[model samples]
Target: MTNAEQPETPLDAVRALRAEFGIDAGRVDQIGRLLTGGDFRTVEEVVSLTGTSRRTVEAVFRALEPDLESSGDGRRVQEGRAAEYRCLFGAREPFGVRDPWTDDARRDPAAVAAMAGLIGAAPPPVQALDHVPATAETVVKRARFMLDGFDLTGAHVLFVGDHDLTSLGLFVAGGAPGLRASVVDVDERLLEFVGAEAARRGWDVRCHFADLRLGLPAALRESCELVFTDPPYTPEGVQLFVARGLQGLRDHRNGRVLLAYGFGERQPALGLAVQKALNPLHLAYEAMLPGFNRYAGAQAVGGAAALYVLRPTRRTAGAARAAADDTRTAMYTHGAQSVEASGGLDAQAAARVLELGADAGEKTLLVGDGWPADAPGRRIALPAFLGAPLPRNLQDHGTALVNLYPGFGASAVRALLAANAHRVGLVCRNDLPLLKDAEGQREFAGLVAPKFRIVRRLRDTPGPGQALVLAERAEPEGDAERVLGYMYARAHGKLGNAWREGLIAARKAAGTTLTKSEGRRAIEASASRPDLLERSLMELPLYLFAVLEGDVRRSVDALPG
Candidate 1:
């Protein structure tokens, strides 16, 4: 009888089918027994035996369906039978098996609405191909965290891989100010697509063709402050991709390498590996971008990625080690609080040397060159002869000479040390460049070696100059007593002018009714007394300096030179 017309028992039918399809004897007998017991009848019944859910069974059967009809008739099936509910394992197979993840046919409106109820929105069909767009909110949140954390203002950045959607989101979120972004990729098609989209959004996108398998392009050498990469995680390409990525960081100095590998439990190992690879370069690893898995699709391996911020490792040599040691001691002992509590002893030591003039008490020569008119009595203006020999006058004054200068230079530094080899107090700036050099060794040797007391003003507020107070030791020495008297006279003349100018301007600015002549007289009198000069200088800024100086004399009256 014809196969279609024949009627057969379940066991006989299953047995015959096994023989025709070359089924294994054991499986054939099992199938026969299942059908004989009424456990299976159609393809659906056979698929149910596999223990898969009904939907999966239906999808599998649908995938096995024929794509074309028999022959002369250009139709899949003749009209009437097409709608008939045929048995599974019948002549016709089911449909849509090729892509079970998505439906190929036009979605039924009712079905679409029903699915929407569950997911909040009908998902875009799988066939509706395009770049997966990340949510604007997600982009903004991630971008803000990156920008704020990395201080990305005015930084150059490179974006690698296909994160066009995320990149667009960053643009919308108003990424770092003055950031220049360059996008690199191997796929020209994707590049064109993203470039067009970026253009539409008014982004100044620079596209570069990069084949990472061959290592990073030469163009990437020390060019970027931040290199952002989002790489795929499949085993096929992951290893090679990561290797190249690590190589890309060689060009970075203080550059940060942001690698976005998807999230998962074992992700820490991957992060650790990346950290180890970059550790030699002194780069640090952190999770800069979180929550990356929401849109990467189910096939993506990891759920989140990490970013590495790198900085050049500082090298320590013998000199640096010594300097570091000294600074450590300074930090622990002579720091801000320590200096404040001690009332600036180191400064005081320097100041004492400047107060005692080079000569004992002979002709005291007072020098004031650009010494801020507002300095205190103990202050002096020494020349910028840091490397030069001490002046003859200074050598003659010796311990009694107080070299007062608003600031010190190389020439002044040398002269101070040589001229007053024993007793000169050198009053100089706290900002002397040599102070910051090699842990202030040059400055320390220059000012501290001569047994001269260095004194400096408390740098609590901004001002034009630094103040120092130096005192010469009262002792019997060769020509020392005479030099001490002369030093006091010089200090009187120089400090008198500084104290006068500072007090006058201060009082005038404070709206004090004191006339210029009156202010000058007051400054002159204050200079005669060091204690009064200090008080007046301090009071000037608070009550003077800010108010309008009305009816003030521009030039001081000629004093006996």
Candidate 2:
């Protein structure tokens, strides 16, 4: 008899499911046994029996739901305390809740609900963007699992990218008292949201803006004990994110990196490619928990990814300094497609201008990240406008085409000024919201009012490109302290006079010739000051030079001159 014309039975149904839906033989057998037996089963039971992921089990049960419902004999039946799935021919009631930890303490519904609401309120994922948040449920479970490993009570945890809102979940979970969690991301909206949430909860969470494609912010490097990141699915993307995260580790030897990546069963090659990317970083593959992460919309990997725990090898510790610069730009989903190029210029064309402009001795510098690395011009590489002094030549009257992007504000302005780029041209996307707001324009004016003249403010939305040239004045009142503050504060956090004193003492104790990094560590270990955060030690000198006007500035001035 033909398969379709054969008499229907439990085994026949299993065969038909395999033929039609591609359900595996094991699952088919389990389902067939459940159909034949007069046993009621829960979703958790089926999941346990088949040794499949919860989501996979759910999908299977969902696919079979219509058929079971049509049977009229299958129904949800309450067995004891909870509802179970029962089908015809002794089928149990349909499975209900999937919570298997019955004995575990119940979660605070209000806290959980708050997180869910916040995640729901976030803007929709951008097309071709690398960021995609896991489901709220998945985030909660992930937080719980992550927290179980270590007591975050006195820990400083760093999240390389928090599109998943794992930081938020950890904050709300609340067991760690002296926990300091910080996040660095390219998205300003996410940063603002996270900052607001931290303020609301009175948590010690800090946010910094940066594009990992350039590098991890100097302020964040070597600042935390633990690191977490959910990077793009691309192999290069994973490597870059992991490398950047490894940079944040306080002690590379003991630091752990938790990474999330997934690939479809049919995409073994893709998974292998991702695995290969890890080798160069010299990470010891500690553990890879299968199906540890779940996504709401990513159905390709069955809406899940695995969590990989990697411990840095000695090689990783030794090569930490070179990790950030090793990443390539085409790490996102769309490669060059997501890049925003304007002014009658495709991405490649703009790259050409950037490359050739420098070669032609036009003093051209690309003021952004994600540009084709193969492009000719050198990147400014200053993710933020920090106090790193510019080369004296660029500090003269040069032309700078600033890429209008995330870190394009006070820092960009400072970078241009310090570089002494006479004509500052802003190259932005057509719809960029730079000069639209009155307040923003006023803020921009306040930053450039004294030193530079705004030659023209061009509005070019829905057009080809917009350009604004800020020309340097003949007799510019270069606010030395303000400029120094911008430079120092951008690179370091808040630094005050006392902090500087402590740092100096620390340096002297370590034999005055200690390197900048060594001096900072010495201060961190020996200083007794409660006035500065551990992360703020590096900023003290900047604070002394910038904020403390007379005595400290005189002291700073007297030392060198």
Candidate 3:
């Protein structure tokens, strides 16, 4: 078997094809094998078999145009040339071959395209969060991997941060009958979008709002069988997201996590640091698929990401338990939240914030980091304050000094509503989006109206784009306000329980005697959506919150007067 005996063999042909077609040797090998398979094939069929893009297949056909016989919708090697071309292929399958997740990957290509369109139409990526949308192909491939690798039937998944919208991707590409998915994100726009879209699709996807730097909600912890995350590409970012993912697992022994990460090829040290961080996590690298993820942004990493399949080791439990209670916030690569960035709201402004909230006393808490030393009683890191089921200290604060600088209005709103502080002094840029205009202020004010009587304490306060917001707990004004306030006060509790008590108490205030059982009956018989009761107010979207309010108020009004 000398080289001369098998002159211009498959290896030589592969090289020749690579040179002549200007395609990579790997792609040349993939398309070469599929083209000479002794059957007519369309461009898509070849793509399906080879896992190459449509353009790559078309280029192959163009390079082989003179030798091939073409016909409608399919083409093949010319009559007697099949054997000649077939012998040019390598003995082994090429690198890109993968078991398709479903016939839909090829047979129903539009569904895949539709997924891309949906992501495009949704909100654009927010740079502050390190959001770079994954390519549609990557998203489809992810769903394929999910369905192909695990039994998603009746499986529970927690998407630790789903700005990628992988939750919808699963529904679009997979047919897992009982797949249960949940998404926890700090982005309200994304959460609201996902919530509405999932509802429209009649999906079992539930969205919970939480900034992972703090903690996961009690309801979401230990509730999923699979956790997937594409976190910011920093060591702290990787660990924090993965830690929250770990916390979401129902049972460590049976659960798994998928992590997407990328770094410039020259920056192997950065990648290594992230991988090293995983050692403390005690996770086995079940698999690593290089360049498995293609992104629309993040060009420094060549617009690609690696997909890591991870499984927990026996010793993963103790460290995972610690992560469940851990609160570390430096995760991003840019903005004030980035790994190297620090220093919270300006110190003098912080003092002003405390001064404005002075009546709150020493029991007051500070929510964010970098506050001047000796400025507070109890201090919660920005991320921890936003954690669901907030630290106990937050529940009993007197006057809390909150640093909401850099326009974290939505998060501040959610955090304050859940806190039982008598008054909260909000520190933020004067031009804060939620307070910049009357309309913005009015809308934001309405969202928190049930809890706080917010007043602009030091409007346009000088120095470092700062302003002070003084929020004092509001007393229930009317029978309706009482019902709303009672329910709002228990925002962290189960909605139905709060609604039931609030209804009975408010009706009693109106001089209407109603038994607890009667109030329950009133709700059961009214237009109230009972399912809303099962959700925590802290997790519910503002729109959904209004719906809950409407349901409760309507249920109360319908009560026998």
Best by lDDT: 3
Candidate 3, residues 292-338: lDDT per residue as tens digits?
77776676665667789999988886787676566554678886677
Per-model RMSD to reference: 28.5, 9.4, 8.0
| Residue 237 error, candidate 1, Å | 5.1
Task: Output the better candidate (1/2) by lDDT.
Answer: 2
At residue 100, candidate 3 shows an lDDT of 49
Estimate candidate 2's alpha-carbon lDDT, on a 0 to 1 scale: 0.56
Task: Quote model 3's TM-score.
Answer: 0.78
lDDT of residue 536 for candidate 3: 72
- Candidate 1 residue lDDT tens string, 1-561: 498844354334433444544522333333223333322244334332322223332332332223213333212222333333122233322211222111211123333232223223213322111123232333444454456557667666666555434454445546667765666554544555555666666665545444343234434434566666555433323333333343444444455555554333323564455444334333344334333323323222221233333333343122222321221101111222121222222344433333443344443333333323332332223321221234554544333333333322222333333233344434444454434355654444433222233443322112234333343333323222222222222221232344345444444444544455664654353232232232211111111111112111121222111
List runs of model 1 lying over 4 Å from the truth: 1-136, 234-251, 266-282, 286-293, 299-561
Question: Candidate 3, residue 82: CA error in Å?
Answer: 28
Could you tell me which 10 consecutive residues in candidate 1 have the lowest summed lDDT? 324-333
Q: Rank the candidates by lDDT, best first.
A: 3, 2, 1
